[model samples]
Target: LSDRLSRRVGMIVPGLAGMAVMAAVLGAAGWLPDGAALVTLVAAWVLLAIPDGLHRSSASALVVEQSPAPSERGRFMGALGACGALASVLAPVTYGFTAQAAGIGCTFLLSAVSLVLALGCVSRVREASSPATPE
Candidate 1:
């Protein structure tokens, strides 16, 4: 998708937002009654993978194209990788605690919140770094 277009942010944002929406739906499904819950969970699970894939691919492509100057790309990738590794190490514990303390549904809701916040951070960084255009 990124190869076919120039707007990496456009694709990345919607992909993540779609992921968040489906995650919220899945979370809400956990709170629904039996048959409805089963149906929703099935549907959401089926839909979830698409946006997850889209976000992963587009975001990675964007990182490559939008990261700092050429000299800093390696450092940037290293930092990004370190952050991802940290998240990998911490996420299971966070999810387990959150699940134990506040039902599994809450974990998805928490992830939705986190995704939104992360998108906001990305947007702010992109905006701050982008060169201003003349009116």
Candidate 2:
């Protein structure tokens, strides 16, 4: 089947949006009645898996597809790994502090904000990578 949607526009957008939505829902769940919160949490988690899986499935393919040259792919992958490492170390501590000061709900809101920032960064990368049209 001819794909109508490019990975840049199609997969990433929905995936990021799903993540943001999940975060927001989770945040709001904190204010819900306990039973309702549990149900919301379950539903949010279940819904998030779809786009998250889609995003993850495309992630390695995206890396390879976007790499300008074979030599640069390693560099790109290394940079990706470095980012994951940094986030792994920083997110828990930063989130813990935010939660301690604000509330658990705030931490999820912060996660949503982080996802929005990630989307912005991805947009910038797409702009940088796209081939320019001649005037």
Residue range 2-112, candidate 1, lDDT tens digits: 566543366667777888899899889888999999999999989988877877776665565565566666676777788889999999999999999999999989988
Q: 1-135 in candidate 2: lDDT tens per residue?
A: 002345556677678778988999999999999999999999998988987776664554566556777667778777777888999999999999999999999999999998888777666545224422222
Model 1: which residue pairs collide? none
lDDT of each: 0.75, 0.75
TM-score of each model, in listed order: 0.82, 0.83
Number of backbone collisions per candidate: 0, 0
Residue 107 CA error for candidate 1 (Å)?
0.4
Worst 10 residues of 1 by lDDT: 126-135
Model 2 alpha-carbon miss at residue 118, Å: 1.4
Which residue ranges in model 1 land beyond 4 Å of their true spot? 6-8, 125-135
